[model samples]
Target: MKIAMVCLLSCCAAALCISRFAIPEAAAKGSHSHSLGYRCPMHPAVLQDGEGTCPICGMKLVPVTASGPASDGSLAVTPDQQKTLGIAVARVERAASSRMLRLPGRVTPDETRVYRINAGVEGSFRDVAAVTTGSHVRKDQVLGSYYAPAAVNTIQLFLLNTAGYDRAAKKKSEGSLDGENVDLISSNLQQRLIQFENLGVSKRQRNEMQRTRRIPDTIEVVSPVDGFVLARNASPGFKFERGMELFRIADLRRVWVTADVFPQDAPYVRAGMPALVVAPEESSTLSGRVAEALPQFDSQSRTLKLRIEVDNPGFVLRPDMFVDVQLSAELPEALTVPTDAIADTGLRRTVFVETAPGLFAPRNVETGFRNGDRVAIVRGLSQGERIATSGVFFLDSETRMKAPASGATASLTSSPDPTGRRTSGGGAGPFQKSSGDMQAEEAAAHTSAAALR
Candidate 1:
């Protein structure tokens, strides 16, 4: 009787333990078997019970399905979520086009064509003829004349020496002098004549002095070249020493257009490239070609100097005139994207690539020469890949908010419950919920409990 009673009590205890634990296990199994849902990371309000993305933010939502084998399958985002995320896409196309680099420059004078005239001798301020800066003069044109006592004395002495030489020559030729005297006199006169000729006494003047028996004291200075007088330093009566600069003349047929290019861009510019020069005060445009590239760089501006040669038949281009120069070079065809597509973060350059509808992944890219509105993609991308051209800023912000591995894990979590807390339910896992949603949920729950009570 004691054994039977003990066995019956043990069986009852066993039954009670099984009932207590088995009920909860069965309930948990049923709960885990239910399908899970997900919500968009960008738009927490959007919820999906299937495998898909959030319709609001276009981000894949966390799956409500349990993780275990018994748990419902993971949620797959529907196409509707893709449309909500404002996902933009572009198709890559291969096209042949040349990239152009433009650089700013200025107009200058050709060094070879410019000349400066200086006073050969001193004496001036008697009169002024070529007074203005831009006045044109010709070769041998008398710019002005001056009277110097030293010059006058030199001319008179030259005339006197010539007269003595002519008389001595006449006497010798007429055979009126002895052989020794003739030889000596002839040699002496020849030396004096050569000296006078070396002093710039023209042959015509010498002949006229011999014929008219007179010599002019005043000296007339003539221009050497046919060009516009760029500068004037001599006055009618102003006395100047030898070799002093009196005028400057330049040939305007050819001019130089100098441009300053950034050191980084200097490599692309070379001789023989086409350039356009536009004066600040004129509407006309001048065309020229790059003649040379200076080896030195401007320390102050950190720019390379480029010289271009142009024709100035109209004499419109002037020295010291500010001008605008356009230099262009052709680049080979390359893969390019809109400039706005790149997000420069100082350390790295990033771009958002749309892997799917409303689904973007941030990718680091290397960029190259940038044209006006487009930039060349040197690395990190292939042709035909969809890239965000416009609205990239917004996409970048959204991408930053998600975790680095969010693209893979976003569809597996649940939306957060009210009060920013995640509920232990089988619906979309609590996504990051805004304060407004939390407040609304709290108010609704409070009203529901009050009504039930």
Candidate 2:
């Protein structure tokens, strides 16, 4: 009897142990199991298991799988799956810097320094003394001579009258000895002399002609100032009228570079701003300050005209020559980034910001003025943030592929009903049961099982 009792105790202990372990195992069997895997967004051929990102794009790993098949025939992606893809990225930074803007412009003569020599009387061109267009001449230098018979005859007549009046004044003074008559004769002589001088006859020439009893035929055309001759219109026998331009001279010691800035940029350009001008054909650069900005906009080009004065003592800068102009101004300090780093999609501008290792999030940004290689960021970002500078398009494509398709149907399951008829659950058909009903059934099954135990 003792042996049989001991055996029964052992059997009871074994049964109890089996019941405890089997119940837990059976309960766990009803629960769903999942596997983890990672993939590269750019290269789908690369796959792995881990909590890391794609090697190519640095995008964080998405959950390997969930409960359904991916639209592209791959397993469903869970929140923890990591995908590696190749990509390029850059870090945002700040430093004291200046922007350089290059523009094409031309060199022009300063209006204040250029001189136009015009004809003073109607006559035929006799000779051109200053032969070349760029020849330098001093003030009062005889440029050319012209023969005007009408002017010459008028001067001769005036001189002859002056001589006769002088003789009459002397005789009146000697004979009358009357102060009033003598003063009248003297006044008449002075009037004739003034008339001759008004006709361009010099005082020295008048005295010599009066003593010699002769009048010069040709009139000398003199330069008004010391400058280089820009143009000459006289020939050996060219006829000229009064007020006709005969020559054009300009002072080359200073030149002007006229820049045609667009109306939109006119506000930025102001007088007294420093600018640099580069000749189109020469390597030398000239520096100057903005002298003035014309208020009116060009009717055809719609551009604002700005003048910059530069010294050209060597006479190297020529009028109408083309040049490159650079205008710079101090700008307010602000956040800036490479222009290539931002992705512009017409409607919106965005940049992919690095949140963590292999993790990036798209951020919309507002931009301001743009310099040569960089642009000012007005909003939506801060300094010292890592952003994808190059190859962002590939990452974007991968993100789209990983996202779930909208309006897609879920998978369905079939099971036997109490009446032996097959019923379907979790599908896109009209007969599909509501998700709430499924949850309720799962809850009831757990409760009933617990009560039975």
Candidate 3:
């Protein structure tokens, strides 16, 4: 009887030990399962109260928290997860936004100051000038002389008409000729003078030819402007057709620098805006004003062209030379944030605002001008709010995954689209079920199991 009592006491102690450890383990497992729900990893929309195969993709479901979505349509992200994802954050503030554009430039001569010298009549150069290309010449300076049969014929006609006019005048003075005859002779003479002018004979040369009563063999070509010769095609004894180009002259007192500005930067660049041209070879920076903003962009580079007029006092800027250009603009002070902080979906632009520690909610915002690294916020946010800048795509993905949870408001709802139109966000997704229905289903299943037992 004593041994039986000892065995019974040992049995009671073992049962107490099993209850102490095994019961709590079972309870802990039940608590964990109750707090979590299951969904197909392949399809986050297929959420269920318990683990099961996905109806659509036929993939095994994974466990997710039943309370994943917060009341304010925010998603909770732990600090450890943020660190692992390399997420970075920044604050919104108010300041004057500015942008600086740097672009490659090329020097070009101003069209208004450039002149092309061409042969006035059919001729061969009798004598070429001593000056060559790059030589500076003064206005009215004789560049070369050319012999043309038209010029000789024109001068002869003028001399003949002058002689006829003189004879008619003398007869009128002697009362041998009528006034009508004298007037007719004078009109013919004026016609001959105009012909001489058309044949490249200057006023002084025409007058000399008439006074001397001689026809010159060659006509002198003179420069119309004081400038440097850009091109010289004159050669002695070389036959040339009328209106053929002989020389190109350009005044380099002012020049144009064509710079390529990107399309995004084109809006701020306008005529009369100040620009700076950097000549690395000359070791100087020249100030200029935007002469024109070209309407079209280059097909290959996709950049807009800007014409800048700069005064070249020492003729430092030359055609076809490359240089650097700087353009800048300042926008009015306003609320701004880093450009990367905003996530643009095709329909609307969103920003994740840090509502609480480790919690972020999406806010729809309207953006103004985008300056280099930052953008202006026109509406929907206040200054001094912190936002995720670096890991916005990851946050967006997390939000999308929790969007189908019933009674869990998703931040992607009821916001103004880019066009300032309000959109409704009151409807539930097709695959979503309310938490109450899921709870009722689980209670019914438990009752069925208890009755079977």
Candidate 4:
């Protein structure tokens, strides 16, 4: 019995000696703890004491600085780690934005500038000009001339009446005029003038006849507008009635471009909005403005018809010419971020907002219209906050892996020694819960207490 007691005392003394001296030396000489070390949030096996990126998945190592309490699931990356991960950040900005709507359409002539030439009097074409479709014409330029007998007789009557009036005026000047005869001559002269004017003779032509005392073989007609010939019906010898159309001319200096706008984009298309037209034939772009939109919407196409009036200064745009149109509209000031920063995970849209220095939190944001490379944040984000613009995938992957693991064991208890050192006596730090316990908690939350006193 005494030998047994001695042996037990010897074993107790040896354990005390090792605990006081040898265990501490072994701990100091061996590998280090993870209290200040960093590891890959994706693969905890990839660990380092300083900033680094994981070789397996190329994810940045996150410092497990958990000597304190558990995290709220926000990822804290140091400046060195951010640089190693190639994370770039930008601040959310508030400014006026503009949206450009690109549409395809075609150009045609302005309807108001279109002119149709018609025959003024029944006559045969005698002197047609050297012209055809697409010929350029100027105002008051003669396109063709016709010879009619009535036009000749009409000129003769005017000349004879003017000669008679000259004789009657001479008699009055010599103090020998008959007053009744003078009124008769004046009435006849006015009637002859109307007949000549009705035959398409101008007053200037009449004055020329009176000066030269001779009439031309044919009366000429002129174009009323400076334009290009769109259609020509009359040939060198074609006969036509009084109201027959000879040519259709249109001023090509200005044109109208029409496009069909989708219903989603129709609200921004208002009258007077400026537009730019680009065509393959033109070396330069044409400037235009929205003239009007037709009242009738195309139900089958689900589109609204839009028209824009553009100035074809060089006559580069032509009827039936295809073109591309760009229309711009102003947008109200709103918080905006880079469009590439948003991550769509099928169920939610999220961005990495830097809640603190080198710390990013996954923010669920509602998005609005996208203007170029920027997107408007309709909700869940505020102005002046910085967010990750590049390297978002890494941040997303790291946060997702760490958040669930930390939450899985948050309810476990912890113990501390006399020296205030945490001892591994529980499942995990106070930031987790097992799956079954979590399920029970959620179920109890949905149940109701019917008999409350």
> By lDDT, who's the top model here?
3
How well is each residue in 1-453 modelled by candidate 1, as lDDT tens digits? 645533433433332222222222444465635544554333444444465533222233443333321111111223443343343468644444544545566655677766766554456547768457888777667676666555566566656666666776787788886567656665765765575443434455556666887766655555666777778887756887756776777777788876778776666777888888887687778888888556467899887777888888787888777778877766657788888888888898988776665455678999987778888888988898987776555445444323322343343353343344222332334455565654544344344334322
Candidate 2 per-residue lDDT, tens place, 1-453, comes to 645533433433332222222222333464324533443333343344444433322333333234322233222111222222224567776655555545567677778888776665678867779457878888777788788776776666666676666766677768855567656666766776665544444455566677877767677666767878888889889998877888788887898887788765665667898888887577788888888556456788777767888888676788888888898856657778878777787988877777766566767899987767888888988778887776454334433334422111111112222232211221122334466644544344344334323
Q: Model 2 scores what on Cα lDDT?
A: 0.60
How high a TM-score does candidate 4 get?
A: 0.54
What clash pairs does model 4 have? 408-433, 409-432, 410-431, 410-432, 410-433, 411-432
What ranking of all candidate models by TM-score puts the best one first? 3, 1, 2, 4
Candidate 1 — what's its lDDT?
0.59
Query: Residue-wise lDDT of candidate 4 within 1-453, one digit each (tens)?
Result: 645533433433322222222122333454335344454454443444466544433334445433321265566666765675577999988999779899887888899999887775777778788778999999878777777665777788778888898899889888899877888998999998887655666555677888887977776766768999898876656677777888889998998988778876776678898999989666578889999656348788777768999989879998998999999977879898887798878899999888888777888999987788888899998888899998676666655545533443222223122232121322222325566644543333223111100
Q: Pick out the ten consecutive residues of candidate 1 with the lowest summed lDDT.
A: 68-77
Judging by TM-score against the true structure, name the best candidate: 3
User: What local lDDT does model 2 show for residue 427?
Assistant: 19
**Between candidates 1 and 3, which one is better according to lDDT?**
3
Query: Each candidate: what lDDT?
Result: 0.59, 0.60, 0.71, 0.68
- My TM-score estimates for the predictions, one after another, are 0.59, 0.58, 0.62, 0.54
Give candidate 4 misplaced runs (Cα > 4 Å): 1-85, 98-105, 120-127, 145-221, 237-243, 256-282, 285-314, 323-329, 345-348, 354-363, 395-453
